[model samples]
Target: MLFPVALLGVVLAAVAHEGHVHDATPDTVPETEFQSWVAKYGKQEDLPFSGPLSFSHLPYAKCLEEPDAKFSVAVLGMPFDTTTSYRPGARFGPFGIRAGSRRQRPGRGYVLHYGFNPYVSGKTILDCGDVPISPVHNGLALDQMEVAYADLLRRPIANEEIDRTRSLALDGVEHPRIVTLGGDHTIVLPILRALHGIYGPVTVIHFDAHLDTWPAPPGIPAPYEAAEITHGTFFTSAYKEGLLTNSSIHAGIRCKFTGMEDLEHDVEMGFALITTDDIDDVGVEGIIKKIRDRVGSGPVYLSLDIDVLDPAFAPATGTPEAGGYTTREVKRILRGLIGLNFVGFDIVEVAPAYDTNAETTATVAADIVHEFISMLLFEPKEKTAESDFRVQAGRNGDEL
Candidate 1:
């Protein structure tokens, strides 16, 4: 069992370079009124984000507020997508997620059933933007994936980046929860390796339609390897490298269209899959409970492929399988993970180009991050819900 929670003791000076969108002070409200407002709202967003402002940590931009060291969660965006078989635009995922989140109305930004804003709770999170990637031709993109892998694998270990991620879990700073938004599932390999080194044997709760654990097809030519290294075979690499724990669960797999031989091969790999049929049988809440128990006590790492949602719910992803978890079902499952020793979480494969209305997946994706941030940041209070509701309703009064 991992320590209830731990943060690498290094002070997060890196994120100090990143900038924050909101600078509204707690003192904006008078003390008496502020206390009354807190009593009324518990902890909820005054408005759902619907604006046109956001911040990022990409090489193009500067830094943001780094808070007073201790934090609970950190978000990193790996925007290299040389591995997707079909759509190749996911390399821009980090920008889209951050842009979506920045547009969110800060402060209880995701105030659904529970008050949420993963970041605003004074949690130290760095939008450590895209990992520096090489500019390769799209046709040869998949072939050059090895370059990104090499960069990710050897990022000057024991360096400042490690110190930043390590300190996120420390007391008085942030909760040290990591939520990575991706270039492809392969991006998880390096991240998991780093995390496993920090906390051994972490659970990888993956939600995707395809069993991503296929062996890297040999030789970099077309035909068999035609799909570029692809989003198709990330897990295969991790599982083979012994980087991922065998106990990790692969949920939301609805892939029966492929040849039975491939299916049998995946089955032999010891992945306990929760197919669409299983999700239907157990109910999302029930399945969530099952996940909580299986990955119990230990530090858990979660990776959600937006395609986990049915194509109807998220048409903007690189790979859109027909039937999958409904939007509501996905929320139920994510919401249930509260209070667990979740080390970090990631949401990948969101390609806005595939969207008819950009809001389809981007909005949902943003809301998911917003909600997760809210859950991890807020200390559970007895009156949290009631207070959040009243305060939200009284925003005009509360803000005044």
Candidate 2:
């Protein structure tokens, strides 16, 4: 009786196996609904640590790859620091800045002072990724940057609401504004070359601890053509190339100069100096007024070297000075220049290897970029006059 029971169990197991194999055939299974699966999993918000890394979690677009891709403003990275005078790791500045910006999501990007969210202000802003730069050759890398920037500058505007009347282009055609994350200060020379092709010579607002307009030092021998266009002397090259307007201004300058002759050369190259000590005497408001008065309503290209901040505030830079603006002072000055006609901007010299674990330098650089987006999207004052607290208080018969 035990043998007969074992045979019966084996026969039942064989039958079940045959049935399972038949049911598991490819044609017998239902196709998966990808749309349903995507609907369930794809719409979630990106946590700061989880998403594909981009500046402030903004959309990533290969603007260079897609010719039809349009944006009002773009965050472009130039990751070549071969021309750096001191630190070398600024080649990674773009990556450090994007990593530092992880906490700034588009949903929470509202500025209380400006009373609007730049991320959601109906303008298409994109992280266009980094320019492909050749590390082995400086000349090749610079030329590549120039070509890439010119292509991006010529792309069609995504926001149709932008006022073409305010454009500084001689043709009055609207062009996209670019906020570049720099390789080093040398990148600005190529950038100015690109901008000159469109708007002609633009007034530059340079924020740096150094004059940057230094000619090759007196002792540096002749026939050193390659040494002439370093990070320190890019502005000198720009002036020679006729890429700058004579009204350019330099703020936060306190770098040790060769002599009064350096100041005379800087002035000759088209820059009015505003020292770091000016903040103590004339105040932040005074600095802003001076910059505004100098640049006026002309097309302005703003360049900020990370060394403009004191080493205590932003130590992850190539060349740092003791007395420089704090992050707060820089932000206030940027806010005060909201209505200026800015065509381009850059934050340079962020060498993250020199930074602390807190990433203070990259973080502050990213926040300043947030201010750039706000300034670019800011509506004309006349349109927002109704929302002014002063006007609202008057209407309600309120007193301070």
Candidate 3:
């Protein structure tokens, strides 16, 4: 039995030999040249997706184990969900996100307004595959993830020349930015540790329904408290460790809290809260301004919990909140943050088992990441020719 033509294209692209990929100017080429290039280039073996399964059919490699290839944006999957408080299936979030992104292959849906296909943005992006973790040991799992992320972030940025002999140390080399497909909200804790090793404490823009800053009850000892290192307590732990700055803020917070102190404790931890109701009060523009004003000009880490979307829009997350932002609203808000100093990002808590036939949840997660990569590669004032004939509306800074 043959796979769907699209899936077959992805499989071939992944296992293809290196050095056969084309650097085409899709927007600038003549019609006859573009058609010839597509037909001939379709058979080339050296292309993106060098591994068996890559996100959005991009190149795939284990950067930590093999340093031969160079990359600028590395996508790593964290497939551990041991610490989830409400549901347990987010261990499969990475797979679901990757599967949903397959539709973006053959450059079909690259947003024209963004002015670039991330795959062809003259930057190297590789799917570094998923990190290995022991399900039985949360502490050990956390340690392994932190170590893996640190190794990836310390890698030197890829240049035109492929230098296989270069050391993978920070050693005055610029590091690649990372976009992680998360197992759960808890995964952000280890990611914070790894990023702090390089960029120091970062300002976080956390989008979630729950605060995730709830502290463990008092009177617990060391070993006992270790058990409290869960999804709900990660932000509190992060604040205590000084991995995040006072400029950190939470958006789409509508979860039930114990009382006024929960909000006060979060404020003391350096977070400004934006409830679901705020979406109506401030509108998307006002919300965008608030985010910019809060994050300022610091290295920013964006952690998006899928539950930030209303259950109507995304019902496949572990904790489905009823009142939350719609997918369109969230996308518009994210687009507004373009050009900010972003170091890393993650969209967590997608559990495909709970999804509808439309696969609404996983598709939204993939779309969010697509916009993220586009934002990462965005440049101001570069205009594509009118005869470029790309699909979709042209995006300007204020148009969206």
Candidate 4:
């Protein structure tokens, strides 16, 4: 059975081995080349999936035909949104983001594995499916999440995360990379919980409208309580729980939801605040440099709450700020951090219900994912040129 090498979750590269799999663009290359590459790398013993490989046909969920890793990235969709204020549809964010991410220009979308072609490179990514959730049952969801993630966290790989550094390795797959598509900022807590347990005291790059540093505030009636373990209270708990390196370096904060005490507590707790006003003063390049300087060479987990995109760009978030970076600017800032010690990122708070035009939030989130993969995966100038071309949108910066 053949698999669709769509994204880089689990790849299907064209090797010169018999019985290997291959995915090639229609009419782009001669059909003979596909078979040739397969003959080289497609060994029957090295296949990722076998025996009536089912579920590999699902749009967002698929099993690899041959379980081998070439720097994998697991993109888990955690669409559970039990705690939200003023917005209730972010549970749809992950699906919306995936739906909008199907971009394949005339030539592109493959480089990391199979030089400038997806089929040749294989999809170097994996969809971990949605994190087990209970949309209607909060406690149950948390319980299920605790149990499920406890299983993940308990894996011996979590103990040596950086050494392994790929979800495939953690999941006992070959050495593959991992990227998480989040349902909310709170999802970062569990990821950090898993990561921190192994690579203790990693620095966090937080991009959001609010500080999210409030201790468990009183539970509010609608959406969420300021203090619940929902989206809003996640960071506070993380700091207390010691997930972040004391929750340091929060960028793109335009609005303040927590009191000054919490704010001050966050600061004393080692959280560095980067205001929208400051970002405005310094360009994204400068801001990224500042963040890199502060963080130095720590293991980085980027947490991007889409509300930072000023309501004009990302209005679907529960907490939208008036003045913030344009989506382009946010991409630029993140671009500068490319090649830095970045582990993974979560673009949270995209409530599709708020956006009458689904493109508004989905596009932002998808673009974020694209730019992230572009920065994290794509190799440098000459290599990228020789590699497959996806979109011609001119991305300039460091590359491996």
Candidate 5:
């Protein structure tokens, strides 16, 4: 009788547990409710902090890998810094700049100054990813950059509505413009070589604390030919190769020099100087006049070294100078040159290992790149082959 009573109690407890489990399970939603749930949460937006990394969260494509890919502008990275003279970590600059652009997105890409969103300007823009660079060999890395840049430069433009009159296409066929995230200042030498192939010599507007035109010293000899291609001497090499025109100019220059002969040689290599002190003397408008008057309307390439900013504003560059232009001044100057035909652009020498907790250096670099995108997509209402009213209009209070 006792065993039978214990069995009956166990059965009752098992039935009670099963009943509780059945009551706790949720019922499936009706078909209409299921569709509403899918509509709310099916697709994920490209949020700043949650999506795959790309510049401003633009679409990513391997331009080198896909021959048929179409884009009007591309952001290419050259992660080669084997030729840097001082710092060793600028090879990581491309990744740092991308990370610093986390707060920017295509939906919020409106520029208050320019009053347009480049992402929606009827142009296909892509982050074409980085060129594969050899870390151990400088010669191979330089060749890799040159070949990669030339290939990308020759790709057909995706937009049929591109105004050819405002562009630098020597042939009637439209070509894509590239903004390179650099490895070091030395990367410009190969880039100039590639541009020379298509556009002949181009006018360069160099913004740097250093002249970057130094040649090998009179007595010393390089152990190898590639050893002569340091970041400090690339402009001289470009000059030797005839990759520059006489209209090129330099701004924010305040680097230490051996003598006045450095300025003389810089002039011979086709550059006029605007020192950091000149900003205080001539003011921002005066500097804008100087750059616009010098570059005129031509195929121009702009190269900006991160050291052009005061170390207070940007301290993570490979070389830092004490006094330089403020970030606002640089942006103003860039805005003032809106009508010039820009064929290419670059910002280099950001060494993230030396950056601050706020990542000021890389963030500034990314902002300047944002400015580049706006500058490219801008179209003037009244543009002519002989006159640059667009630039004069920007200098005044007119929208571009």
Candidate 6:
């Protein structure tokens, strides 16, 4: 295949500069990296964006194919939405979210109000690119996703001085965390499985419009059967596999159930529900406290279903519901979660096919991810004593 000269030049520029040292005198012979870059590539507009598809256009964002290197966190894309019960194009969520995040590149300052920059917080962040999925087979797709996440978890965490006093590090070595751009809520099942393999059963902090803990559809001979792998039933599968703790809680729920028994069943599976209506009664602070109280000091996994926001604010999701929280409300709530023992996170159900000119849903998805990264860097408003939480780091110093 013949390549365009501009594209070829950009590719060659990237390939040629991997380990070359630049001379510093700009006027003399293009010594420094920027000068050498300009001399070699001609101009900024001449080269294509470097690095794998990444959020925030971070320079450190690297492809997973590179020899293993230390990174505090990695953003992995799970572009598999075959199991969605409603709309299907969430398969493009990672792409849409990445495009939306590019809008932040010029500023690269996501948390303006707090003045926190995750990229410069002594933590290396990588965009590990998207996991390949078997489009025709949902079961195989999920299996592939689980294996991908597992492989990522095995890599070394970037070397950083962890604040044992406020960091999520329960052991001496902090395992790199993953911030997953989800294909759909079903993606959580595989992610949870990989996380469970590393951290044991984690307490869940689920934010969604639906309970997602519905009993697996009938006629599946046994629990967690492949036929039962729809988005709505994965939590049940997670529960069956002992991947979650009774301390788990679901916020922003508004989906109607067949009967009260469904809620009872969810409780039995060890999850508490904080309906969207409860947000008004308890207030955001109260809701935050409830979440913290429920999750306590256990290792926690956060799953954010964009549909948890009212369709008015985020209509691009697959299963949007009315009467859900506003974008601002959700942001504040997530910001409140900063000091918890978060192990991993996902923002799912962003089907940009349904979005308006505003790119409302994709932008919101990016912002949610931004907050997750913020949580990784910001000190909790109040740091608890190191002895308060129970954290056992795995043998490799990269697993929890």
Could you tell me which 10 consecutive residues in candidate 1 have the lowest summed lDDT?
A: 57-66
Go through the candidates in order and give each one's C-alpha lDDT.
Answer: 0.60, 0.87, 0.80, 0.61, 0.86, 0.79
Per-residue lDDT of candidate 2, residues 1-400 (tens digit): 9999999999999999999998785954553697568668775689988889899999998788888888999999999798887768999999999988999989999866776788998999999999999998888898999999999998888887554324678767889899999888999999999999889999999999999988865565765566678899999999999999999999999999779999999999999999999999999879988988888677889999999999999999988899899999999888777766789899999999999999998899999899888877877435543224223222332221
What tens-digit string does per-residue lDDT give for candidate 5 at 143-169?
999999999988888886554433455
> Tens digit of lDDT per residue, candidate 1, span 1-400?
2443333322343344333424435556656887788889885532334332342221121112222323234455667676677787777776777766645544325454554444454545444334555546433443343343333322322213221223423232222455667776666766665655556556678889878877566676664443434467766656665666656777898875458767766655546667876876788766876776666455567888888999888888887889888888888677666655566677889887776655678777876776666545544434344224223322323333
Instruction: Order the candidates by lDDT, highest first.
Output: 2, 5, 3, 6, 4, 1
How many steric overlaps are in each model, in order?
32, 0, 5, 44, 0, 5
Candidate 6 lDDT by residue in tens digits, 1-400 = 3568888998888867853545334565437988788888886521224444567775543445665655777888888888888788899999989877866652355355444577777777777788888988888998899988887876766755433322343343457788999898899999989887777789999999998888877776764468787899899999999999889999999998899999999998899889999988999978988988889877889999999999998999888789999989998788667657788889998898999998888888888888887776654334555322212111112332
TM-score of 2: 0.86
**Candidate 4 lDDT by residue in tens digits, 92-133:** 777777655545221344433213432223344445556768
Q: What is the lDDT of residue 317 in candidate 5?
A: 85
Q: Highest TM-score, which number? A: 5
lDDT of 1: 0.60
lDDT of 3 by residue, 1-400 (tens): 4569889888778756432445434677556876789887774542333435578887788777886656888888998888888878998999988877766553553564665576776778888888998889998999999999888887767743221112222343456778899898899999999988777788999999999999875778877666778888899999999999899989999999899999999998899988889989889978877888898777788999999999998999888888899999999888777766678889899888898898888889988988877766655553443222111223431354
For each of the candidates, the C-alpha root-mean-square deviation to the true structure, in angstroms, is 16.6, 7.4, 13.4, 14.5, 8.1, 10.9
Q: Clashing residue pairs in candidate 2, if any?
A: none
lDDT of 3 at 157: 76
Model 1 earns a TM-score of 0.67
The TM-score values for the models, in the order shown, are 0.67, 0.86, 0.81, 0.68, 0.86, 0.81
